[model samples]
Target: MVASLVIGILFLVLGMALRYWINRRKFYRRSPIGAESFSSYEKSVGIKFIERVGKWIAYALIIFGLLSLWVYSREKNDNEKQTKAVESTR
Candidate 1:
């Protein structure tokens, strides 16, 4: 349970970092000349690649984190139930 929780937290943090990077890149992509130029500028192959792949990676990380947390919660509850049953029997 603890291991799962730790893994979940780590994945979540990594996902968050990637998300921040994506957003930061977008924010900085604006044209200094004018808003019109921002839309006119075409994305390079590398930037486009990162934008596409990074989004999927971030999504995967977040999903894995959530799944890990869910598993941790389920195990924790099961352990608690077993301990309670043992104590009651005594």
Candidate 2:
């Protein structure tokens, strides 16, 4: 149970970090306040491909993390219910 919760939290943080990195990379790729080169604003095909792939990876990680947490909570609730029933019988 604890492992599941920890894993879920870890995945969630990793996904958030990955997303932040992708956004930051895109933001910084642009030209500064007054740039001389127009090429700085242009995104290469490779960069676009990486960004698209990274975006999907981040989304998958986030969804998997949420699902793990949901499973963990369900297990915890079931355990609690069994414990309560046992106590009531005693």
Candidate 3:
């Protein structure tokens, strides 16, 4: 149970970090263009790359968070069952 709690916390933190990174990347991409700017094609490509990377990171974080929640829930259910069984025997 303790281990599961730790792992769940880690996953939550990791998901938050990934979310922050994706937001930061998007903010950078959307910021105004300076006097020295890349061509339209180059800018488009950069934006596309950032979008793709951000999507992948977001997906990974979501999956990790879900898995952690699943594990925690399962552990809790198991503990509850054990307690009930012990009480019944008593």
TM-score of 3: 0.63
Model 2 stretches with alpha carbons more than 4 Å out: 32-43
- Give the range where candidate 1 is weakest over 10 consecutive residues by summed lDDT: 34-43
lDDT of each: 0.85, 0.85, 0.74
Q: For model 1, how many clashes?
A: 0
Question: Per-prediction TM-score, please?
Answer: 0.84, 0.85, 0.63
Error of 1 at 19 (Å): 0.9
- Cα RMSD (Å) per model? 3.1, 3.2, 3.8
Which residue runs does candidate 3 get wrong by more than 4 Å?
Answer: 31-47
By TM-score, rank the candidates, best first.
2, 1, 3
Clash pairs of candidate 3?
none
Instruction: Give lDDT tens digits, candidate 1, residues 53-79.
Output: 998999899999999999999999999
- Clashing pairs in model 2? none
* Candidate that scores best on TM-score: 2
Question: By lDDT, highest first, what's the ranking?
Answer: 1, 2, 3
